[model samples]
Target: MSKRSNWAVPYLIFLVIFVALPLILIVVYAFQGQDGGFTFKNVTNFFTDGDALNTFAVSIEVAIENTLICLLLGYPAAYILANKDLNKSAVTVILFILPMWINALMRTLATAELFNVLGFSLGKGTLLFGLVYDYLPFMIYPIYNVLLKMDTSYAEAAADLGATPVQVFGKVTLPLSMPGISSGILMVFMPTVSTFAISEFLTNNKIKLFGTIIQENINSSMWNYGAALSLIMLLIIGLTTLLLGGDKENAVEGGTV
Candidate 1:
């Protein structure tokens, strides 16, 4: 192999050991029974079990809610931060970045404590709040990076053509920023769907997401079942990635046109 290709050897090895091996193990365990024979029981149980199915539904609902909230809040924050006309000082950007510097668990615990001090009841509302607070940065930064790197000449030309500010934004800025929006959606949605800690800590274990179910199964020594659930989650995430990828491609094509 050439010298340039040789540089990827370590990364390939890392993927094989860390990523590929774990996935292979999950697939193996998912298909095997307690007696070590191949069986479809685990997968079937996931669909047939009412509690698991309900938990999965709840997880999807929470993820969708959190993703929407992040998009609505993050987009405006990103737009403001990206727009030099709106935000003059570079120092203001530090306010958002600073929160991310601290550990996520620490942040979650701090948020939970704050809620208690404020006399707020911990439940779905607090869970949603924690989700948004933790993942909003993920949504904002992707859009901010895209908007920062976006071509300004399109907006300038639209203005030159007597387009209103609203028209310029709708016809130009929004289309160009779709790639970032897609990226942000994927980042926020994927984690929220599989997240257990935020739900557990924020709601005091009152609310159980899909991840919590998986964790309980594993903790109770239900390896095959847990792996099946994990595999199912992986498949859903994969399908979402493919769908978003197609949408992103279409958006890029349409924007260019």
Candidate 2:
């Protein structure tokens, strides 16, 4: 073992204690009944319960919409920012990132106040807006990083070969940026699906997403149900990550070929 390898010891310990331990507890709780006996009812309820199914569907819809909107908006912004001729691009990037420095709760509360001032009614539309606004940076940063790090030679070569700007972007830039797009989708989608606070503030507790349902369950001392719900969410996010990971890997391989 090298000395540099020892540097990971603390991180490994932290992961096991905080991350692994909590996941283990969730699994344990998810299978435990109110009488402290093993049962699969909590897990089954996720599939069989109508309310649970509705919440799950709503969460999926919101997450998908949020991800799509972010991609549509973030991709173009990232492309613009990545332009070499854009003056003060660094400053523009900084401005985009500056909002992240404030506390999330503070920012969320401020957004809620802004909506109130504008007389926007609290509903699903506002909730969607809040989700997108809060997570937009997560989408932008990944794409921007990938664009920034990309070699210009590929694009220049394509241009020299008489490829139009659209063709160059479609064939070269977009394909090469798949890894970043995948990452951004994961970052935005996962958080939006699991978000409670944004829904709460934006909709005034009228909208109950998966995260809100989990929060309610836990608060009402339905730990087993809550754990099961959380595990379901974990599975969805895990599957999404796997799918996107495959796409990213394929993109990288394609780029190399």
Which residue window of length 10 is worst by lDDT in model 2?
248-257
Candidate 2 structure quality by residue, lDDT tens digits, 67-90: 999999999988888877773458
Which tens-of-lDDT digit does each residue in 1-257 have in candidate 1? 79999999999999999999999999999999999999999999999999899999999999999999999999999899999999998787778767778888899999999999999999999999999999998888878878877889989999999999999999999988888888888888998999999999999988899999999999999999999999999999999888887677533432231
TM-score of each: 0.93, 0.92
| Candidate 1 lDDT | 0.90
Clashing pairs in 2: none
Q: What does the lDDT read for residue 7 in candidate 1? A: 95
Tell me how many clashing residue pairs each candidate has. Answer: 0, 0
* Cα displacement (Å) at residue 110, model 1: 1.0
For candidate 2, what's the RMSD? 3.5
